[model samples]
Target: SAVISQKPSRDICQRGTSLTIQCQVDSQVTMMFWYRQQPGQSLTLIATANQGSEATYESGFVIDKFPISRPNLTFSTLTVSNMSPEDSSIYLCSVGGGAGGTTRNEQFFGPGTRLTVL
Candidate 1:
């Protein structure tokens, strides 16, 4: 199993500022994804970070606003650009479980970075 951790457990940022969240995994992973959980809402997919390629952003997200980098299988970063109060949410990093077990479709998530834009 892979253990995931995120930096800066929580933060308060001024509007118009930005924050970069880091995700690190103990083991190498092929598929790493970013997600946002707004207050009282379900998690929303932000993007899929793949090594050696650009991160694929979800429908409602754009690369310019949420740039992502997957330097390697064990590390990835997500930057919230020009953040606004609406961007306040819990950001999470998730990695798909390795194959060959009942863990299919299973994913491991980081503790999450809670951000509040004021």
Candidate 2:
């Protein structure tokens, strides 16, 4: 199992402003994922970050709006470029265990940063 951390756990920002959320893991992980959850809704995959490569974003999400950086095996950052009411959601960071039958195969998530755009 991996432990994940996120910064600025919750914040209120103005429209058109941006916010950068940081994610750190306790151990090495092959892949790091970013997600967004609207109030009372399920998590939506935003992007995947792998060390040494550009992040792959989901459809409707772009690098310019949601840039991701994976600097090493246990750390990554995601930036929300322009804040909007629509972007006011819970952003999460997660890592999954692959090829293992243990809980490592399950995805462990950070405490998620809740953002509110005014």
Candidate 3:
């Protein structure tokens, strides 16, 4: 099991501004993923941060808009660039379980950082 933490449980930002959130893990992990949950919406994978490599973003996301950094095995950061009211959502960090030959892919999510744009 892995424990994760995210900064700014909630924030209100104006349009066209950006916010960078930090994520820390208790143990080393192979992949760290970012997600966004809008009001009354399902969680959506934003990107996957792999240490020593550039982040792999999901469709409709670009590095210029949602840059991610994984400096080490246990820490990462995600920045929401050029924000808009449409970008208001709860951001979450997740880590998958199981190691070595185990194929378990269970993901544990953070409490989430809720953002409201005005």
Model 1 TM-score is 0.94
TM for candidate 2 is 0.93
Candidate 3: count the clashes: 0
Per-residue lDDT of model 3, residues 1-117, tens digit only: 777889988899999999998888888887888999999999999999888999999999999999999999888889998999999999999888454222367876677899998
lDDT of each: 0.90, 0.90, 0.87
**Model 2 lDDT tens row, 1-118:** 7778999899999999989999998888878899999989999999999989999999989999999999998899999987889998999999985611216558989999999999
TM-score of each: 0.94, 0.93, 0.93
lDDT of 3: 0.87
Instruction: Rate residue 6 of model 2 by lDDT.
Output: 98
Cα RMSDs of all predictions? Answer: 1.8, 1.9, 1.9
TM-score, candidate number 3: 0.93
Q: How big is the positional error of residue 35 in model 3, measured in Å on the Cα after superposition?
A: 0.6
